[model samples]
Target: MAARILIVDDDPIQRRLLEEAVKRFGHEAVTADGGEAGLATLAAARGDFQLMILDLVMPDLDGMAVLERLAKAGETLPVIVQTSRGSIDTVVGAMRAGAFDFIVKPVNHERLAVSIQNALKISALEGEIRRARRPAQSGLGFRDIITKSPEMARVLRLGERAATSGIPILIEGESGVGKELVARAIQGASDRRTKPFVTVNCGAIPENLVQSTLFGHEKGAFTGAVDRHTGKFQEAHTGTLFLDEVGELPLDVQVQLLRAIQEGEIEPVGARRSQKVDFRLISATNRRLLDMVKEGRFREDLYYRLNVYPIFVPPLRDRREDIPLLVEHFVSRFAAEEGKRRITGIRPDAVAMLSAFNWPGNIRQLENAVFRAVILCDGGELTVDEFPQIAAQTGHVSAIRRVEGNDAPPPAEPVIIESTLPPVATEDGLIGVAVSSGAGNDPAPFGFLRSLADDGHVRALVAIEEEMIRLAIDHYGGRMAEVARRLGIGRSTLYRKLKEYGLADGDDDDAGVAAE
Candidate 1:
């Protein structure tokens, strides 16, 4: 989670302060004496730095000029600009030049940290969506991959090298790990970028038609062969051929597949002769082909041929660093598509919870979760409330029954409520309570609210008032007057509910909340 950041400033004091702040926030910081040095370090680092904190005012090469140069060079690195002048003109200019954010000089630690996080999140979104500018399937390059984890970095490096030739690549990973995307990237980066790129899911086709599907069938070659069909091999002539779930190929078809790889020729069913095809073969399988080979399901020779330049893409959980990036990108994309453009980002806690779950279905599952969260989001940002199912999986206490159409914001902790079960009268009208099990299941039992303060004495009136005030504040969206009125108390009584319950500044008219 600690990203490397470059701090650029002409003044040593400012640089030192920023560097300390960055380090204090648990990130690695590299200092540059000025703008020129920052750019030089960036050039040499070769994507080593995730973000830059640059002072806008410098001698020869100012922050604005640095940003312009970066944009001209097609760099998407995020920059946070700083200046003593808090003028709107400077901020607008910096933002126009692609600065992720602008902060006034002598930065506040909290503000600087927030800016750094937002810039990183935006940088990640840029990295993932940059591929959209190109063709979705065929024209994507290694840079289009959204990954900050070293595991994926290694995979991309291997893939880039394999893309330089017509090497037979056997991509191996769990399902939905983006194996097909890696294959397309390799093909796009290869010499056959403009040629046909055909994909075949070997497992999805019928067992009887697998051969005909891959090698084509002549007109009336079989019962359902009504027309002369061009196979995937022929379709990918002079380009790349992707075989997904190759481990599921029929045993007999494996022999024909081996021959095709060995001689680049495919014999269509009912055809006396074989036709040669020029295509780069890239096969992907979630299973271990070696195990299949041992079980006599997969042909060993065919496996060896296809596995020449193997690239293994790690699953989403293995590369946890990519989750936040992918989630942010998906939220942005789905929000626009759903016409909820106000939903810009997800809360850090939501991202943290997502990062903790081991995605059994890999990237595909994570993407779907984000898409659903975006659609369910009712506010400007996504929170845990938007991901109730996932939160329950993480053992979060959201199991309490929800009232339809109730839009009260989620409490910091489980909001204790009276149970719907047959009530046992305790005192006055207060009934026995039940605690949520955090599993979205019925709670067995928990005692009623204790009247004593653990000293064999009844609780004080102020203590009971404090608890009621806190609960009212959370339930009523922090409206102080409404909280006091609901509790049948004066405004003075509500003010006493402040500091202990996290409202540090309680002197304002509505406790800093404006009238809605």
Candidate 2:
């Protein structure tokens, strides 16, 4: 079906241009001259349009204000902002206000079409997500799990099939890849959902008590058995039993577990009576069970029995495309839970840094980072400074440095430092020096310091030391002792450095301004 779009611009020529562009793609277009008229048309038509092409500078109502009003009214139609020539600030401001994308004046038809196509794609994906979340009566539908990636979707499908078949399932993935969430999703969608879903962490319990935990024990069974207790299997009868970290089960205990799973009965400790229990089983482990089996660490027969339906959850790094969505979800959840509404979103640079990192701990680590960032963030957007680890690990100095308003110049090109410094020395001494003037000629003894300062690489106190001393002197009315104390420098040394930097007697502020 052809998509319908609304074009809202004050200029007749621009509106006609956009209308022609929309028609060239075989789509329908509606045009409005200003924001008020566009909003009225939108309300009267009740979101009949699939997208909106809005002008950033309309006379009656601006594009940003219209967008804010639309968001307030719970309307989420994709919007593409149209900016005049050389209006980058307006374009960026529109984007920050939730515009899908922007196009400069004298728009290229090809680029405009591509942006429209992308907007339509985003709209379609959101529609699919909404449809996927619709509840099903049988509890065996796709709504039980939340995922967009093809790999996770395939796993959910396999899990759904296995849940109906009453076969044991083994989920394999890295730790914190949401293995237990998948297990619970399966249980929730199965016929046994109404029954108790018992879970046991094999690695968390002591080795001696694992058997008793899984198969129960009679009164006076072991040294501390006070009364007869039901095992996980018995407790989960007619339901599902999820064994997490199944690879951690000891060899001797594996034998008993294998027998209990094969047969529908368990022989409790110190009890002559054997009890029958019926339950579906689901197990998850991060270890390679096949390797363990080959090494005689895990029983092969037990592996086969549990491997009836194996599902693997891909790590977060493998599916980086989902990071943006996940960030939005987590930010909203955390903000609501913490009762803080000041934080609106994350800075673009921080998101880039987050996407670039190799998430060794998967989604769990990402969640923790977001939670920490949200807690430390004062208000507004979260920046790279909020996440020190991302900056440290990735060596990305700053995600973004905004040039406020139109007067500010565009950002400078990023400096790529390729150090020729040799392997760092163990002792506190300069290991290598910059060669200058001749082959391996270290001109100045402090050449490394000059290089670092010139390249704007100095950080923290050293970067601020010279400036702080000058500022303190000026603030303290030029008392040398007070300036030294405030700067945490000896009075004599302060005077020496001041003279060295040509700042003696307050000659020049530039002399004491360190590169940052």
lDDT of 2 by residue, 1-516 (tens): 146799999999989988998998867899999999999999887545779999988899989899999989988899998877456677677888889998888898899988997787566556545434432322224543445677876887887788777888999999988898888778777777677778899999998888888988999988889999778888988888999999999999888888878997888888898888898889999999999999999999999999988899899888876676567556656765676666656776577767777789988998898998889889777877677665445544321111011223222442222345553432222232221211121121212211222222333564345545544664566667667777787766887787765567564333433310
Q: Pick the candidate with the highest TM-score.
A: 1
What are the TM-scores, per candidate, against the unseen true structure?
0.69, 0.55
Instruction: Quantify how close model 2 is to the true structure by its C-alpha RMSD in Å.
Output: 16.3
Clashing pairs in model 1? Answer: none
lDDT of 1 by residue, 141-246 (tens): 7876778899998999999999998888999999999999898889889999888889999889999889888999999898988899999999999989999999
Query: By lDDT, who's the top model here?
Result: 1
Cand. 2 Cα-lDDT: 0.73
| Candidate 2 off by > 4 Å | 1-144, 399-516
The list of candidate 1 runs beyond 4 A from truth reads 1-7, 12-31, 44-53, 78-129, 136-138, 400-516
